[model samples]
Target: MVAVTSSVPVTDPTLLDALRSDLRSADYTLDGVRSLLGPVAADALDREEALPARVVTASALASGADGRATLLRLFQLGEDVTRAALDAVLPTLRTAGAERLGLVATQGADDGDAVRAVVDLSPYAAVDAAGEVDWWIASDLGEVARRGALPENFVLGVGGASRTLAQITVREPRGSVLDVGTGCGIQALHASRHAGAVVATDIDARALAYARFNAALAGVRLDLREGSMLEPVLGETFDLVVSNPPFVITPRGEAGVGEFTYRDGGAVGDDVVRSLVTSVGSVLAPGGVAQLLGNWEHRRGEDWAERVGGWLTESGLDGWVVQREVQDPAQYAELWLRDGGITPDRDRARFEGAYAAWLADLDRRGVEGIGFGLVTLRRPALAGAAVSPWRRVEEITGTVAQPLGATIARVLDAVDLVRDLTSEALLGRRWQVAGDVTDERYFTPGEASPRVMLLRAGGGFARTVRTETGLAAFVGACDGELTGVQIVAALGTLLEVDAAALAAELEPQLRGLITDGLLLPAP
Candidate 1:
């Protein structure tokens, strides 16, 4: 592993206190920055386009802006600031203190004249089940700020994948939680809110250093360690584990291909993700859940579900995989290539070479496509509770609501509720359509009955199920007023069919709907 000797911020309590006070005084927060930059520039910055923000902040600086703008220009835009200006903005910490904290480096021989931020510090705000949080996170500067490719061991700030994992993670309070591959400690930081104790591990020392600094900045304690994957937490079980692992599949020993520690796990194909899925069960406490984001290969002639399901089968834990997106070989190649800051517009030769290498590497492995998704695994709370582990692999390639942790928890509970239920037992319980569920019927011209029926979920995976006449009637009658047996019998009588056969056909469907959160056990 590459060891990064880059400047990492120091965790000085007094300096941290001063910095926090100055940040609060300046109103340097998520909403504060957005309000200062306006919607257009803020949105552009979100897209990693820095020109709009540069222009706006330059204007603000020219007009003798406040401390927020000064800090924004220094940290977010990677601009050099006059030391005097920084001193005025951060009066409590001042220039000397910032230098001591390793947040900035003085330029030339004149220490009081000019300095620039060595780290990226920004405001973060989010509301999960635990409520609202506003904190400052510090990590290495990004590609846009650096104006070039990232180093192999570069510690990353909060990105799309991290944010997605945070939003989807089950957020119930727990005794112990673990964050594997805790880049910038974003996941660990989120876990700290509800968990009594959080242990975060990373293979990169610089990452751990950044995580340490971030934890200090946020005033949250984390047990930080340096190791790859589960090595740091072996033999110790956690109530919950969350990871945004380095699951990106990158080619090995190919010319013009470089490995980035932040994304590459140095494994062939998708072995990294496979290993994690199969082994994470060992670290999970009874009834503990592990949530991860990963990329899996779609090889030619091999079903993706079977391939991923094989991993779950080896795990001996209940597993659910939701594939949110699929990309063809070329699309995936270009995406990661550009992500590494090698763009066709910037360097055509290098881009084409690396792109060809990616295609060749994937073609060698018979990889036709790449799948990106979320993985949730749980160890059965009771020994011998399940004869076999339950596994569900599905594709939901549409927009879903954020803060999906609660929805996922409900789905897990529903799975357990129906896992051991017989058809008769399921029929004995009253069921109701979820509040987010609605049905639509399509009719042919002049037809008395609808030609097609659809059941749609307004939340969760935003799933839509096509329904036949019998199933439609059954679902329509599910008002919690009658048991499943009564509903199916009524539908059968109304449709002039055998009640037993109807029940047999709709039993699996009802279980599916319940697990997908379209139906619920009535109180």
Candidate 2:
């Protein structure tokens, strides 16, 4: 384990209160910063380019700008400001309070009495399924500010992965929720809005310290603990479990490979994610759901679905795995290398060495490509049920709706409903096409009838399904006015086929449409 220092922010109530007041009074918020930096600079900052933002902030400071610019320069852009300027901006929690909180440090009389931020503090705002939130997050300064590789125990603030997990998480109200590997408490903070109680656990003590401070700053309560995955919550169950675990596959025993606490689990070849998928069910309450983001390897002569499905098979829970992206081994290596700040332009030899190590390690294991995606698992509500555990593993590499929590909840319900029903019972229910669904028909040049048909959804996963004439007619006739049996019988008569055979042929497709949100059960 890596040794963590005490340089993280402290949770002092009085100082925090004062800091909050000053921030609010100065309008140090997302909109405020955006207005100050304008669209170009703000967009540049989003791309991790700091020069435009630095130019804007430096100009603002030279012309005696407001507190927002000062804070942006000092805390966000890693620029130093005089103690007098900082005190003026943070009148309530002055330089002394900031120093006490470990947010900044003074350069003494030799460096012109300047102060620099030791940590990164910035505004965060989001309007998720749970509603809108505007808060400040504090974490380790990133490579953009440090101009070098991140420390092994670096605690990350809101990044692309954090936002991705937050957007995909199912956010229905629950009694208890657990956020595993809660780096800087971003997901836990979002969970607090819908859950009655939240317990966030991490193996890194430095991460816990940052999470604690963030919870205090946001005025949210989280039962924070220090332990590896599932250890802190042993023997306890939660209504929901969410994790953005350290699933990155870094080469072990490689000379230049970095062991980052935030990304690497110190395990070999996607085991961190596999272990979580197979074991998270032990902590889920009956009918509870666990949503996670992970990466799985696609090795030679092995199908990715079968490999990931094997994990689900061992979990004893209904599961859905969506592979959103795939990268070849070489592409995967370069991505993580640049992510760790070892760019070819900066350190050619080190970058080449690390890249070689990554390829060698992956090749040794017969790995060809890597699959990244979302995983959702559910414990059956009725124990010892006769129905087989349901599993859906697929690849969807395209645009989809944001805040997919509601769609996910609905899909789970649909799956459960269809799983328990017999073929005849399912046929007895009336169904209708979702409003977002539409069909396209293609005909041979001058043919009187259409030859090919397709069904596309505008929402949810934006799935498109190809159909034959019989299935297309079935979907077109679905208006919640006729049962499945009635529609199939009518189509059978018109197509000169047996109703029983047509029903059997279309039953699986209907169930698939329902689970994918293309069709819905009538009220």
Candidate 3:
């Protein structure tokens, strides 16, 4: 195992307060950083390239840019800066105070000594159900800054997956919430907004420390625990649980050569995700929900749904899984290898060995491709109730709604509302077409009426559904002015078809439309 030096700062209350003040005074927010770096440099920095940022910052400094530029160059780029520059940028924390917080280290004894950021601190902003929020997030430096493979226990900052999880998580108010593997506490911070209490756990001590520090910086309280998977929350039921766990499938060899605690769960071949799916429900309160992001192995002749659905079956919870993308073994290995900062062109031999080993492991297991996506699990309100569990596993590659939390909440509630309602009962209630739903028709040019009809949602998975003429007419008639049966009977009368036949065909479609937000239950 390669040893890594720890550079994360201690979370001292006094120092944190001073740092926060200094950060705010320097306008070190996301908008502030973007304004300082300009669009090109910011976009380049976002792609893990530092040259554009370096050039921009150098030009800004030469042109007499303010404190924010200096702070961004030092902390964000992991570059060394003069002590006087840092002192100017952080007058409240000063040089001595920053050292005490373990945020920076001075190289020489003189005032001209170079100071370097001990951790990567960046400005993050997101708009959720509760409105806009801007925060300063701190984590271990990335491979771009370190210029090497990540350490085994490195805690990652907010990335695409993290943001995806946050955006999809239902933000309803709850009594208690759990965030498993809460590296840097991003999920936990979001949870704290609506949840009465939040618990965040991680197997790595370093990760827990980072979480603690981040929670403090964000002014959110989190119950920090040190354990793996469900160990920390044993026997503790929660209203909601969310995780962006270590679900990455890494080939384990002698002494766990390439295992990372943040991504690898110390398990082989997607078992970690399977285990979490099966076991996480044990801590869910009745009518509770758990959301997670994971990857599952797709083997020859094996359907991805069956592999993931089986885990949900064992848990006895209603499961909804969406496979957003799939990658073959080579693509998967290359993506992760580059994520770990290993370049095939530069380190050909090492990359080849690791790549060959990963593919060989997949070959041994008969795996063809890997499917990555989201999972949402719900515990039934009543264990022995007549309501049958709903299991939906499918693929969705199109763009989904932002703040999908609202869509998820609507779907879950709609399922409960109509779960026990028979076709006769379903038709008795009035329905309305969602404002975001639109109807489109396609036909060969010059044809009179449309040959195919499509019902599309502008948000929430942006799903598009093909409908026959009868179903399309029924949906168009839903204006919250009449009952579903009234629309179906009226459509049947107009189309010269049996009313019951039309209702039977349209009832199932109604359920799907409602769940996908194309059809809304009347007020």
Among all candidates shown, the one with the greatest lDDT: 2
The root-mean-square deviation over C-alpha atoms between each candidate and the true structure, in angstroms, is 2.6, 2.6, 2.1
Q: Please rank every candidate by lDDT, starting with the best.
A: 2, 1, 3
Off by over 4 Å in 1: 1-5, 108-112, 344-347
lDDT per prediction?
Answer: 0.89, 0.90, 0.87
Kindly report which residue stretches of model 2 are placed more than 4 angstroms away from their true locations once superposed. 1-6, 109-112
lDDT of candidate 1? Answer: 0.89
**Candidate 2 lDDT by residue in tens digits, 1-523:** 1122337999998999999888888889999999999999999998889999999988888898589998998888878888888888899999889989989888763424888888899999998776799999999988787778777778889988889889888888999999999999999999999999999999999899999999999999999999999999999999999999999999998877677899999999999999999999999999899999999999999999999999999999999999999999999999888887888898889889999999999999999999999999999998787778999899999999887778889899999888877899989999999999999888899899988789999987889999998889999999999999899999999999999999999999988998888988888
Better structure of 2 and 3 per lDDT: 2
lDDT accuracy of residue 450 in candidate 2: 82
Q: Say which prediction, candidate 1 or candidate 2, comes out ahead on lDDT.
A: 2
User: Can you give the lDDT of residue 458 in candidate 1?
Assistant: 95
Candidate 2 global lDDT: 0.90
| Inter-residue clash pairs, candidate 2 | none
